[model samples]
Target: MDRYGDSTQKPRVHKAEVMDEISSWDYVIVGTGPAAAEAAVAIRELDNRGKLLMLGAERQLPYQRPPLSKGLWTGKDTVEELPLRSAAEWDGLSVQIHLGDAVIELDAGARTLTSASGRIYRYERLLLATGGRARQPELAIATLRDRVFTLRNFQDYERLQAAARPGLTVLVVGGGFLGAELAAALSRQEGLKVHHAFAGNAPLAHVLPPTLQKVVLARYGKAGVQLHPQHRLEGLDWEDGSVRAHFTTQAPIACDLLVYALGMESNLELAQQAGLTLDKGGVLVNTELRSSDSRIWAAGDLATYPDPVWQEPCRLEHWDNAEATGRAAGRAMAGRSEPFRHQSLFFSDLFELGFEAVGRCDSQRVLRVAAPPGGGKAVVYYGDGDWVEGVLLWNVWGKADAAREGIAAHRPLMDLHWVETLET
Candidate 1:
């Protein structure tokens, strides 16, 4: 045997090695939410040759989740009207979407993933846009899990709409945006009795100012929606398909339908299992949206990345934030480096009222100014110093861009000079 005879002509030739084929892609993004969809589209725009795979646990194609609670209750078609992109657009994109299939395991070290069907997928880059799951009542009993509802997806709204017949007693638990929105929509159904167990003094105590909270409470009152303020759910009874909801501040109420809109819990199980760095219950990433593992990145609600504007680590779940973060991640994976610096855009429409704004909405102190009798708008400023932290354009249209700039501008909180300038 010749140990070193490579120079000899026709001495020895090694046969071509056959590599076992495993499912592989240039990019594998988990979760079919806004972040994942936007990321895939951006990636396709930049790199046409890379194989992209988007995994979603839900059966439905990727659709906007906001309208599910916002207006789906008003007889909107789930499949026909709710897609983020049209069918033709989806077909045009070179993305392999795995609907109803979820990636259950992620081996970051191996740069591979395993879906629920035992398929191994190797990826050059991974994005975990696996958005959060809706939170439910802690006292939910076993038999009642199916009966109780939470509005996190389009299907949930469809189910709730079917059960929202007249003469039904619906008990909504929570004091958050979803809870308020759902209760308001249900209250419009004549003959249906809607009771909202708000665990705070106001419907949106967590975000809205006390003044604005009053306005919301008044709206709920006018709509015939009963508000059980400062209340908490103790337990639930699922007997004969009816919910006997017991609350701490009120007596037991028997209801035909029970829906709770408690906040959401970030879907961090996969990231945690892979030993990714987590902080404040979210996967921590730098401004580039790169996670601790380097191979894996995160975006959307599940990602807590440094906010370049605020100079702090923040997690935003709004549609704009998701899209922005997703595009940023996609660009980076395509070899483009740029920090994602933008304010979060959030908006909510309840019944007939709608408002949109940017920047932080949490500020205890605000300068509330009412529009002149016919001005058709009002404004709230949360800035006390040079940093204009927030601005609320109540009933104001065509001012979102300017308002955002104002909030970003280092305007004095409120001075006679600034006030005169504002008036002018």
Candidate 2:
């Protein structure tokens, strides 16, 4: 079963029709996420007369995804506020939308797409903002599939919320953003015992430096989260009504529910089927977010575009990246093409600690931490040799633009003394 618990059975094929004004769209976007929604709005703003159609596999309308893991649990935001744009707003743009139908086949040369419902539509311009699905473990068994959940969409959030009742033992796997945030959120529940298991010694070990990692781990502990560091999940077994999670080095732990946040695998099957240029990250796109086929474009988590700062193609799965790339791709499709130069920043809230970071904030790189003499908010600079690569504002606010500019400058660490000043 797919994420929605729907069978993967192929739908009956329907005959393809000759391209006509009725069946052809000036722009066809295949997604309902923020990327696709933003692209639609941008297209309508520039080319109001264009026939635009958006196809979404999900039944619900496009909604902001971050709140599913962050604000919803903390009562800062509600499900009612998740919609990116209401149905009336989309209708006002004259954008045709088809939900619960996914594009299963793509013919780039023909500029045609076949949906799972067997309907084929021709497009003058196509945007593949297919986004991604949650990555689950290899050892997940079929018998306990229902109990093993992966939170990606609103439906998954609903299911997980229903299962995460008071007094239930929940084992959240992975230490990445989603895992850490989910663990923190669930722990805040009145009586839920949340166990965070990951391969890293501390949460966000791959991104945050050792200092911030220690701070995050301590915060989670203080929030009543049971930390299972270095516990690489090996397998799972069904024990009565509970699920037993077996780790590589640690003893098996039983939990009432298991949720995996092992990161996302981009929906590249459509891109691959279309024979578009791809890298290990995602579909290769130029600065303007155009794929190998000039008529086709990609955005959001699936577009691995050239980074102006890193000077390398990077696939960023963050909200800012999605919105910026989607808008850029839409404008490009609308004949207002411009090289996308936005340096996307990502932020996360764990308990009371909040952070905003830009560029390649990898922990493996040389890191320099700048904090006040009294010890409060700090800034962490990641660099390679003499040049700065990324910056993290720990509990620091209103400096994301400065951080992005710093990364884009590609200046030596010695010359970028202004980074420390941002801490103030």
Best model number under TM-score? 2
Candidate 1 runs further than 4 Å off: 1-21, 76-78, 139-143, 238-242, 384-386, 415-424
lDDT tens digits, residue span 1-424, model 2: 1233343454321122233343889999999898898899999989999989888888667888998888999899987788887777877888888777788999888888988766789999999999999987765466677778899998799889888889889999999999988999998899999999999989889888887788888888888899999989888998877899999988998998899888899999889988999975699999999999899999999999998766688898999999999999999999998989999999988888889998888899946888777655788888778778888898899999888887787766786466555666
- What pairs collide in candidate 1? none
Clashing pairs for predicted structure model 2, backbone only:
none
TM per model?
A: 0.88, 0.92
Q: Once model 1 is optimally superposed onto the true structure by TM-score, how far is the C-alpha of residue 419 displaced, in angstroms?
A: 7.7
Q: Candidate 2 — which residues are off by over 4 angstroms?
A: 1-22, 138-142
* lDDT, residue 216, candidate 1: 81
Residue 152's C-alpha lDDT in candidate 1? Answer: 87
Task: Give one digit per residue, the lDDT tens place, for model 1 in 334-382.
Answer: 7775787767767776677766767776636565554456543456666
